[model samples]
Structure formats: structure tokens, C-alpha cells
Target: MSEPVKVAGLTVRPGEKARSVLTIPNFWADGQSLEIPFMVLHGKKLGKTLYVQVAQHGSEIMGLDALRRLINELDPGKMSGTLIYCLPNPLAFREKSRATMFDPKPGGMNRIWPGDPEGSLTERMAHKIWTELVSHADEVVDLHTASRYCPVWVFYEADGVSEKAPSETARRSEEMARLFGAPVLYVETEAYGGRRTLRASCVDNGVPAIVPELGGHAHFDEEAVNIAYRGVKNIMKDLGIINGDAELPKRQVKLKWRADPKVYVSHCDKGGVFIPTVSLGDTVKEGDEVGFIYSPRSFETLEKVKSPQTGYVFTIRENPVVHPGERLVSVPEIIEWLEN
Candidate 1:
């Protein structure tokens, strides 16, 4: 058996059943108290290490539910490998908010990649997580969902296109997504500017990682929960962590990629109440009216939202209220057969 890996000051021995919580000091309201909570599950058999983390952006709760169910169903005595469950920043989660204390003022934890141990609270937490949890794992799955006001479909972010070893990371992400059994996987090629982002950092260090969107935030949907739950189990099965057949749906959904940048941003022309006529997964063509914005009190149509390209809708705002320059929808310009 291979030797165990150490993360965040914790030593995880291979083929040993163990669970422990790693604390990050003063991550909450200033330097008042510690806030981050991580649960490490080391199975009794040696296998690949996988890090399953949730609530990095605060509002994504589907991952939490999935992780809860996973822990309940997983039996360490009948398993192999190590699974690390990390709550990188629990303050935002406790407050039921997206982004952390330093968000907007500085930025969200998800955007603060690699991190600085001597930086702000969020940065320190990020640095610890990277050194301890993320850097050690053979594969990483970061769970997320849309913000409180938006509902999005399941997708994966594999920003491996810009890298020199594109296919290497892309293939690993595709395999992980397939193991998770998600219906769709979206590849994001654009850079969002933070070097500390989990996905970016993983790729930078040659660790295959993908961030799966688990639907919406705050409230839980039974179907979405089931999808995420089974998906994690399937991933475990694929990793040889468990030795049993995973009951996956027969009609598995194939992955589709979005190739155009213009399809991802739809701005509100006039500030008012915005009503979406199309839902996530809907398809539209150029010049098609997607939605409209109007006065909430008067119900008068002030502006209309139209598709600028032929594509599939991936994300939409559920909240009717809108402001000028806000993103109302995100559609992906579909690319076929890239995976095959």
C-alpha cells in the first residue's frame, strides 16, 4: 500500500479508519473565533484520495445535503481510500450568504486561489485548505449552485483549454464528471482573474478537479439531491473506494460543451422587474425574445431580452427584480462530439 498524505497539519494514514475535524482560527467575525470545519474520512483500504468540499461560495447547499447523505450511507469498514470533506469557510454558510466576510470589499473565497497565509481571514482559510486538503488529493470535486436568486442546471467547469496540457486535465475532468453521472458538463475557457480559485489551482498543480453546479441555493430539491447523492456514490465506485455496483440511471445524460463567450452574458437593458420566458436547458435562436423587463407596479414592458446566438440556456435568474447592467441569463453555444 502507498503511504498516507498529510494536509493542514493532519496526518491521514492509508488503510486506516479515521475521522477528524481540522479548525481554522479566527475565520469568523474578525479574529474573534475559528470558523472553518473539515471532516476527513480515511477508509481501511488503500486507494486514490478524493476531496469533496462544499459551501465555498456560501449559498450552495446541495453539496452539503449530498455530503450528509454520503456520510450516512458510506461504511468505512467496507471501503478503500480517503475522502476529505472540507467546509473551507463556515462563516458564510452560517450566515446563509454567498461570498465570505471579505467578499465584494475584497472578493469571495472561491476567487481567492492559492491564498496568502498572512492575508485576510478568507485568504488564510483558502491557503490552509490548499496546503492541507486540495494539494494532497488525487482528484477533487468542489460542489456549488447558483446564488439564492437564480436557478441553474447541473454543469462542470473544466478550464483546461488554456493550459499547455489541455487534454490531460480535460480528460480527467470528463472522467470525473462521467463518474458523478451528471447530465451535462460545461467547460469554461475564460479566466475570472483569481489565482486562488480551487479549480484553477488544481489544474495549475496537475491535480484533476471539477466544480459541479448542483441546481439552486438556500432551498433543497429532492430530485437534485438524489442526483448529487447517486453521483457521489458513482464517483466512489469508479475510484475503487467501494466494491459494489452503483445503481445508476440507465439513460445517462451525455455531456455537451458551450463554445461561445457571447452566449454566457445577457445584460438587462433597463432597470425594472424582469420576467424570464425561458427556463434552464431551453434552446433559442438569434432574435428570439427570451424575456422582458417591466415596471413592477404598472406591469408595463420597458425592455425586452432576446437571444444573440443559437444556443442552449444554462442559467437564468429566478428573481423578478433586476437592475440595469445585471446578468439576466446565460446560454451556451453548443458544440457537439468534442468528448467522443
Candidate 2:
């Protein structure tokens, strides 16, 4: 028998659905308060509860589509555990960044997790959402996209977070990432624990979570959305929240991170007009040609940009213009994870 679930001031029994908007203690520039619109989906049988959220940052929007379509595909009448779906930080979505117009810091919401209840406006909002929503969940799935300048692949936390020893939890996290079916699965540990991202917060709190970084910046790509949609369904199936056989992508490659630079963020050496020759997901070798830099005035080629390592493009600035020492590309290599 499934137990009752409580969140956002609402209690949900098995085999039922409840929808509501959670009001947070924050406001927009116009003084309009912020809220997280959500739905509680309880399945007929007992199983794990998966908490899914999106749009913590303003620019990332595909999460909405994935959640909506996932809802359409998922029938609570036939589900097993419960699924909590919420859109956190509406102010960020309204302004298209993580921080609200009232936020003093321009940095987005991903860096802060389980935030301060009485702290900054954004942290206050984070505190309310975490306390009222994610705290009770058994698992978490956060959807996201790259900035307007580039595309990204799906990723999850790897072993050695906060420089601690690898645990079974990290392996469990990797298993969930594999079920996501994204061609590129980056196993990164650098952005864990202290970062305070929602996923990081959940991982630190004894919950296994994954962040699916779908491509398309500032807009929804039907192709990417479909891929994301399939990924979510696969996750739901894997968690036993919903009934279905999980679909797997062909040749899902794993990218392991060793350190900061090893993750492969390529920066511009000299300021100029940069043009990308490679698209997202294209393979590259160290010193492989990726793009070119040109003079802004006459648009004459000034430098030939090349790949810094042997990997695929995890992210690339779409804008042709570039500045010296600015991050122009990110090429993450495929690496094998060591057994525990």
C-alpha cells in the first residue's frame, strides 16, 4: 500500500492528482509576489517518489515543455509511487535568469540550494521551495538548457563530490544518468556539494538526483523537446513511478571529469569576431579546427580556433562575436569511470 504524501501545504493520497501554486516569500520588481506552480501525481502502487523541477534560471525553458508533455503522457490513474512537479522561481522565468529583478546578484539561482529563509530575496524563495517541496522526495530530476550562446548535453554528479570518497550513492546517481538516454552523459564532481545547486542540495541530502541539460537556448526545439520528453519518461519508468519499459539511446557515451580545465571550457585568446565551424555533438580532436576569429571591421580572418582536447562540443557560443579570454567553447572528452 502506498503512503500519503504532503508538500506545498497539500496532502496527496495514492491514485489521486492535486494541482496548486506554491507562493514564496519574494516579489518581482513590480512588487508582484513569486510562486511555483506544481502538480502532485500519486500512483496506485507504492514505489519511489521523483521530484521534477525546471526553470531555476531564466534562460532555460525546455524544462517546461518536458514537464508538460510528461504529464500528458503520464496517467496518474496507472502510476505507482508519486511524482511532484514544480516550476521554481517564476521571477527568473519572467525575467529569463535565475535571480529575480529584486535579486542583488546577477548570478542565476543554480548556485544556491535549500537557501536561507530570511536571506536574500532569491534565497528566501529557494528556502520556501526546498522546505515545502523537495525535502520529502526520494529522488530529484531537474531539467535545464544552455545559455543563449550554446547547447548542452545531459549530465549528473559523479563520485568524489566535495573531495570526499566515492559512495554507492554516486554509482546509483550514474545508473539514473544512464537511463536518461542522452548521447553525452558527463560525470562531473567539481560542481558538487558547496555549489548549492538544487541537484547538489538533493545529493547532499541523501537523495539520488540528475540534471538533464537539453539543448536549445532561450527557445524550445521540438527535436530536443522530444528527446527530453523521452528521457523523462525513461526516468519515470526506471524509478518505477510509472509503468513502462525504459527506452535507451544508442551508443550513450560517458564523459568523466578529472578537474576544472579537464571539463574543457575553451576561451578566446584574442578578442575578435568568432565563427563556429562545428555544431553541437560533433566530434573533435585536440588541435582540431572548430571555428575562426575575424576582425570586426573588415571581417578578415585573424585566427583559426581549434579544439583544446579530444572530445565533443558540450557547449559553444553561438554568437560570432568574441572577447579576449572569454569562454568560447566547451569540449568534454569521453572518459571511463573507475570501479569502486
Candidate 3:
């Protein structure tokens, strides 16, 4: 066997057994450290390298739980290639915050991708992770969840492709999405010029990476966990990382856009207690009464919120309290396409 390669102060080896942890220094904090935890499971035989990561943003808890289960259940002895789990930004996790360090102007680590070695705390951490972990992997799965107020759903942002150029990237994305067994796949036609997003950086570097939305923020959902787990197992089987009979999903659903067609943000015209008359995933038509805004003191209905388009509801605000112009609903236009 060949000796492990060291890059950006991280030592990575190809072997039947592997374990390592990298402590990367944050740019903003001189004395503090950001622990990017990881575990490498190499099987007795050589195979492909796959990296799975969770909680790039602090608020997404489902991915973290899913990763925990995967680690506990996965046996390296029967496996093939290396499996690395990268968990960066451990501080936001402890504080139960979605993004950034605690107190005074919180920020998000997800937006700081392909990071600068001498930038802000989040930026520098991103740089170290990309240089040390992401660059070396053959396939990557960056897990995430919705915001604290939104419910669970599956969505991915991938670059568009043309017929002339080899669409290997787009094809890889679709294959991974199918392996994930999610109900939706969203492709971003335009690139968001941010240097810090993990998916964007990966695409720029010719890596086939994907961001999976397993569940909502903060709390753990069992259904979402099961789905994500199965998806991962299927991917491992497809990649030859593990040898076994993986159950492939019977059918696959593809969603072209991330934002739902019927999605309309019901902003509060006046600040008051928001009362939702409809639940998420409910079907409604244009002008249908979805909810009502009430005055906190008088208990009078101030405004009635109605659907703007005909579609299935996907997201509803969890917190009832609202400010002026707060979004209350997200409805996605359901499209059922027959396979050719």
C-alpha cells in the first residue's frame, strides 16, 4: 500500500483502516479553534472514495443525526474504498444556532466556500476544508436541511448543460439524485457568484458533488432520516463502495426549479399575530382562503391571506409571530411527468 498524502496540513492515507481529525484555525479568532471532525473507513479492498458531510450551517440537525446513524451502522471491514465524514463548524452546533458564531451579528458558514486562507473566521475555515478535504474526494454529499421555520423537502442546485459539451456533470447529478431517492431535483440555470458555497466550488473544480435536503431545521424527523439513510445506502452500492443488494427506488421524481411554481410569499401588511388556516402540502387554488392575520390585543381578523396560484403547498412558517412583510406560505406547482 502507498503512504498517505498530506495536503494543507491534513494527512490522508489510503488503507483498509483509517481515522483522523483536523483542527483548523479560524481567521476571526486568534486564540480559538474550529474543529473539523472526520472519520475514514477504508475496506479490505481498494475502491472509490466518498465524502459525506453534515451541518455546514449550524441549524440543520437532520443531517447530523443521519450521519451519526450512518457511522454507527457502517462496518468498514466489509467495505471497499475510503469513506470520510467531514463535520466542520462545531461551535454553531453547540449553541443551536443556524449559522455563524454566537452573539452580535451572526453569519453563515455555508456562504463562505472555496475560502481564503487569510479571510474572516468563516472564510478561512472554508479554505482549509476545501483544500484539505473536498479537493481529494471522488464523490461528495453535502447534507443540509431547511431553515428552523420550514418543513422538510428535497432540493438541489446544479449548473445547466448543453447538448454539445459532454454533460457528465449534469448526468452525475441526476444519477446521485436518483440514488438519493428524493422526490425532487432542482437545477440552477445561473450560478450564484459566491465563492463560499460548497456545491458551487465543487462544480468549479470538476467534482460531482450534491447537496441533499433531508428534513427541517433544529428537530429530528424519523421519516426524513429513513429516506436519507436508504438513499445513502443505494449510492454506496452504485459506487461500489459497499458490496450488497441495495433496493433501488421504484420511481424517480424530477423537479426542474427550486422555487415552486405556485409559491407566493404572503407578507403581513400589518404586524400582528399570524393565524394560518391551511397546513403545508395542502392543495389550493387562486384566491382560496389560506389563513388570516389577527390583532393580538383585540382578537379581530385584520387580514385574510389567500392563495395566489393553483398548486400544492410545500412550506409554511412555523413561528406564528410575525413582523410587517413576513412570508407565511410557499406553494409548489406539482408536476407529474411520465417517463419515456
Candidate 4:
């Protein structure tokens, strides 16, 4: 039998299910408290513990629905390992804002990892989550959402300075991402800045992690929810936490990262109503006109937005109106195609 796991003042034994909330002290202006809710499922047999969290950014709520469905579907008594589903940032989630609105410097929750107990409000909450939950997990899945036009994909951390030789944790994270069954896999090869992110921090601590960016936000996207559900189940199966094989894509593309100036993202040169000529998942070569910015008043093309490199169009702005220097599209560099 699997041993008992304790977190957030709750102890879950083998073949059991439990839920609890971790209170964040000194969280509100009126001296009220905030709580981070989490669910635990401990299996009957011993296996790797997988920690999955959603809604780090409040508006990104699609993953939460997906997680709810997953929790309902999973049978803890028939499983071999444990699963932790957590909602980490209550302040942002409650306000439906990306950051804690009241904090003086509420950088998005994703930016800070292994946080400081005596730091800002957001940091204090993050610190509690890191120490009490994530630090105990063998693997992690950090769920996020992108624009409505963005396709579902997985991101694994890589060494930007030395892309060829990645750390063992990063390599394991890549394997998990592959089993996640996302159509696109993004390898974030950054040596710095990303270290503070949840997945990167897990990798730095020798715990494999992957961030699955689901499609759309703020609403119930059935397609995105299905994708998230399947991906999590696939990971569990691959990890021997559950029975069955992972249903993955026959072929998936891996994108190489560019940190210097964010070559993946193409910006608008002139402010206007931007219209995209290419849709998400479209392949385009460098210098190809992917979109055009037009002035509604003058009825003239202000500028033609082109692809920065030859790759897949992963993210396109859904909002037509845009200003100069705003991101119009993100086409990551396709490094290779993996056959599954």
C-alpha cells in the first residue's frame, strides 16, 4: 500500500480522496485571509506523485474546468500513485486579473517560484504553495491558457546557452511533454529569467515538469477542455499512475526558442485595425505577409505584418484593433518533427 501524504493540514492515506484549503495570512487590506484550494487523490499502489495546478492567472479559467472533469473521472482506489490538483492564486483568481490587483508590484504568479515567505502578498502565497505542495511532488503539470486563437501546446525547459545538452530533469520534462499529446511542443531554451517560473523551478530542483497551455481563456472552451483532460490522463498513464497507454499525435513539431528579441513574436509596425491572413497552425516562410494593418478612417493599409521566421503560426491576436509595437503573431522556429 502507498504511504500517506500530508499537505495543507490534510493527510490523505492510500486509496483515499480528500480536499483542503491553505489559508494565506496577511493577504487582504481589511485583515481578512485568503485560501488556496487543493484536492488530493492517493492511490492504493506506490508510484510517482503528480502535481497539477491551474489558474495562476485568474482569467485563464479553461484549465480549471478541465481539471474538475479530470477529478471527477479519476478513480483513486484503482490507481497506483497520487494526484494533486491545486488552485494556487486565489487573489488573482477572485479578481479575474492576471496579477493580484491590490499588490503594489503584483507580477504574474507564474514569474515567481519557491517564493519568499516575507515578500509581497503574492510571493508569500507562492512560497506557501512551493514549500507545502510542489516540493513534495515527483512531477508537475502547470496549466495555463493563451489567446482564443492559440492552439494547445506543451512547453519544456531547455538550456538556452547549450541547447544540445539539457539537464536530466529537463530531459525528463521533455518526455512528459511528449506523452502529453499536444499537437505542438515548445522548447523554451532560456538560461535565465525563466528559472523563477514554476516548471523551471521544478526542473532546477530535479523534479520533471511541463506547462500545457490550453486553448482560449475566460470561458468554457469544450475543445480546449477535452485537450487538457486527455493530456493529463495521458501523462498519468505514461507515469504508471494509471492503467492504459497514452493517446498521442502521430507526428508533432518541436519549436526552438529564441531569447534575444523574441523572434517567435512578430509586432505591428503601424497602429491600425490588424487583419490576419494566416490562421493558427499555418506554416509560413520568413518575409511572408501573415497579416496587414489597415486604418479604418483612411481605408488604407498602414503596414503589412510578415512572419519573422519559417515555422508554424502558434499564436495570433484575436482582437483586430492593435497599436504600433503590439504583437500580431508568434511563429516559433521549427527545429524538428517527432514521429510518435
Best of the candidates, TM-score: 4
C-alpha lDDT of all candidate models, in order: 0.70, 0.75, 0.66, 0.84
RMSD in Å for model 4: 2.4
Count the clashes in each prediction: 5, 3, 3, 0
lDDT of 1 by residue, 46-76 (tens): 7777888888877777777878988877776
- Model 3: lDDT to the true structure: 0.66
Q: Would you list the rank order by TM-score, best first?
A: 4, 2, 1, 3
In model 1, which regions exceed 4 Å deviation?
1-17, 24-35, 103-106, 148-160, 164-166, 193-195, 245-263, 294-303, 323-325, 337-340
How much does candidate 3 score in TM-score?
Answer: 0.81
Clashing pairs in 3: 59-98, 112-196, 113-196
List the candidates ranked by lDDT, beginning with the highest: 4, 2, 1, 3
Model 2 — which ten-residue stretch has the worst lDDT? 160-169
Per-model RMSD to reference: 3.7, 3.4, 4.0, 2.4
Q: Where does the lowest 10-residue lDDT sum fall in candidate 4?
A: 158-167
* lDDT tens readout by residue for model 4, 68-179: 8888988899999999989998888889887775444444887778778888787888899999889779999999887778878888877543333347777788898898
Model 3 misplaced regions, further than 4 Å: 1-15, 25-34, 101-107, 147-151, 161-166, 189-195, 216-218, 245-263, 335-340
